[model samples]
Target: MAERPVTDRGEVGGASAAHASRGDAARRLWARPAIAVAAIYIAARLVTTVFVAVGAAISNSRTGGAETIGSLLMRWDGQWYWVVGVEGYPSELPLDAAGNVTQNAWAFLPVYPAITRAVSFLFAGQYPIAAIAVAVVAGYGASLALYHLLRERIDRSAALWAVAFFAAGPLAALFQMGYAESLFLLWLHLALLVLVRRRFGWLYLLIPLMGYTRPGILAFALLLALYGICRWFRRRVDPLPAVQIVHIVLLGLLAAAVGFSWPLIAGVVTGDPSAYMETELSWRRGWTGDHGGFVPFEGFIQASAIWFRVWGMPEAWGYVALGILVVALIALLVFEPHVRRLGVEIRLWSAIYLIYLLLVFFPQSSIFRLLMPLSPLYGALALPRSRAWRIGVLAVGLLGQWWWIDQMLVQGTTFWQIP
Candidate 1:
């Protein structure tokens, strides 16, 4: 080769040094947790936006190009949220011809819609714009919270991987939709982090936010109750102080109060003692006929039988399957090494939340969205050191994201296709 121009060092050495400098800079940039989390969240949101665009295009094509992306994003529960924001919940609950309570804005909580309505002033009073903005922004915060929460238990690399999975997993489209899930998740992750760090004081604020953002605060209260019991049992080892015990008790009570406060408010507004419960049960009526009253765990059992019969299986098989599932989950939390790696607080929250869901939620297409709270378990999936395993999980999650968007957003033309 002709003589390469080099001042002091050889050409190869200079080029190598330049490459090394660039590599070091890249490492330094990635070392910052916020930057890495933002990068992951931004990239994932872009992918989800593409998926949403594809769904919107497909939906419009099917509907003679009449639907816009905003309308598509504002479908299903989004419409309900908008109604809650603009019109407000009715003083009188809507009733059907049969004199049963019907679905109304009371079924949806106030926080997300209230926030969206306020933000809409910035977007020319367009609730859709404001809703998506809130969801997207809260989703980014949730991602950061989740990364830090995982970091409390796992290594930095694994925590980042967990966030990657969470941001790109199935139902990721909710982050860009008009739903309250993203905001609720933000509060939930922060609440869990504070709980893990023994910062019970933060929960006084978080509990109300979570209670109004979604219906899962009761489960969190239950978690706190169990957490206190566990602390008491392990006090010899962990030394649960008197102050900490008082926090646990007061927070548990505060969370429970807030959790039940919405129902009480709905009852007061509508002049129907069972207004909120009846409104929620109105949704389950579509599948199970008419339920006379709200009963814990009854919805799941009835839904299991109904779904199993629809699927051409014996109804008893559904009960058996439910039993098996409960056992399997208990085993996973108690025995699985990967899950144990996520630490006790996460595992306890998962168990409590699952129990709460089983108690009140009817099994439906929306169950997937409801299960988003258990996302901390994703850390377990990211724990294995095998590169192939991590990549496989990530690939599967993206594929699921596309499938969920298509099924629930694009081709969701029927009642059961609710997201």
Candidate 2:
């Protein structure tokens, strides 16, 4: 007898138990509830294009830009991609221009244009609506991802409902826009889901692409990378019970990196990173808080009305809308305390996401559509437990979402033009 195997039952049992858990996890899909099949069940959420039209009406009614009459959705950054992809950027500036946007061509260089170009080529420009169409696809694709990711811990039924919430939020309107918010969210969530699984090598490669995708994603990518590395090292001693401290420190640095990246990069290229900062601060377009410091808590409070309310007043409502959205998010998170594995799973991931959204509020529009990716976490927290209530609330939220987008996408008198 080969030296009577000396395997300790505790260690052997631990390995055996781990395998058993994975096997159980695999079966979760078959045993999953009906709600988890959210993507298939709630195909009505695909009316995103219809809602996009609604948002255009609301946005246009408030804005009076040149494109407002024909198709109001084609304002600000929207015009950039259309004109650039449809008609490339101008290489030369008019005589008195001194390098200001003498023409409407320059906004296309970011990731949005590249996606648009590919789409237009594939469609043969038979429809200049390439960007918006891509957005529609991205929105649904992200929704599908959310369902699969959440179905693991929550009942399948609730997971499906969460998909409903995501598809039906103002986030859908943001997704419909010619902007890159939808694409960015899709990328961020997929990357994060990967992170949750402890796959670091892939996480590093994805961060830079994310960085290039939107302005601050690079910082987000970097911060996540740092955390994953530290966690890996700490794994030698077992998951750090005190690791939360290190996380907080990393988060602070992440905020700093994101805040400074725009100006810092510009400064290096233009021999003055503050060039970007000057554009934002010299003008009164963004947050009124101290330009050099972080966005204060009070600033967020002031912007509370942006998410749900009309926030008709520009300065006051801007801050007020964001504040309200923040509150709503926190409330939802708290209500679903059971979802964090019923308190077993700490709320750190969602918290980090919430904080990231708050920090970026100073620059983005007051509503903070950036929190869209964080919704799956909230949805995960609320599922299968309530079942009926969960689906009902999500239905209302999703319907209201379309209405919101519809209302936003209107004619000149309805939308606001930033000074």
Q: Which one wins on lDDT?
A: 1
Global local distance difference test of model 2: 0.53
In candidate 1, position 143 carries an lDDT of 94
Once fitted onto the true fold, the runs of candidate 1 whose alpha carbons sit more than 4 angstroms away are 1-19
Tens digits of per-residue lDDT, candidate 2, 1-419, equal 45435456667888999999999886785455433444343454456555555555555556643333225444445666676566654443222224321223332235666777788777777324677767666666667666666655566566666666676654455555676666766666666656555444454445544554555553464455456566667666756445554553555455455545645555564564334544433322233333443344433443443432453566555656546876886766567555455221224446555675555444324244545545656555365566677767767766766555444444223223220
Candidate 1 structure quality by residue, lDDT tens digits, 1-419: 34445543586788999999999999999999889999999999999888888888887777776666677778899999999999998999888898898888998999999999999999999999999999999999999999999999899989999999999999888998999999999999999999999998999999999999889999999999999999999999999999999999999999999989999999998889899999999999988786689889889888888889889988777788879989999999989999998889999999999999988999889999999999999999999989999999999999999999899888887889999
Q: Which stretches of candidate 2 lie over 4 Å from their true place?
A: 1-42, 52-76, 83-109, 125-128, 218-265, 268-272, 281-336, 342-346, 363-365, 411-419
Question: Clashing residue pairs, candidate 1?
Answer: none
TM-score of 2: 0.63
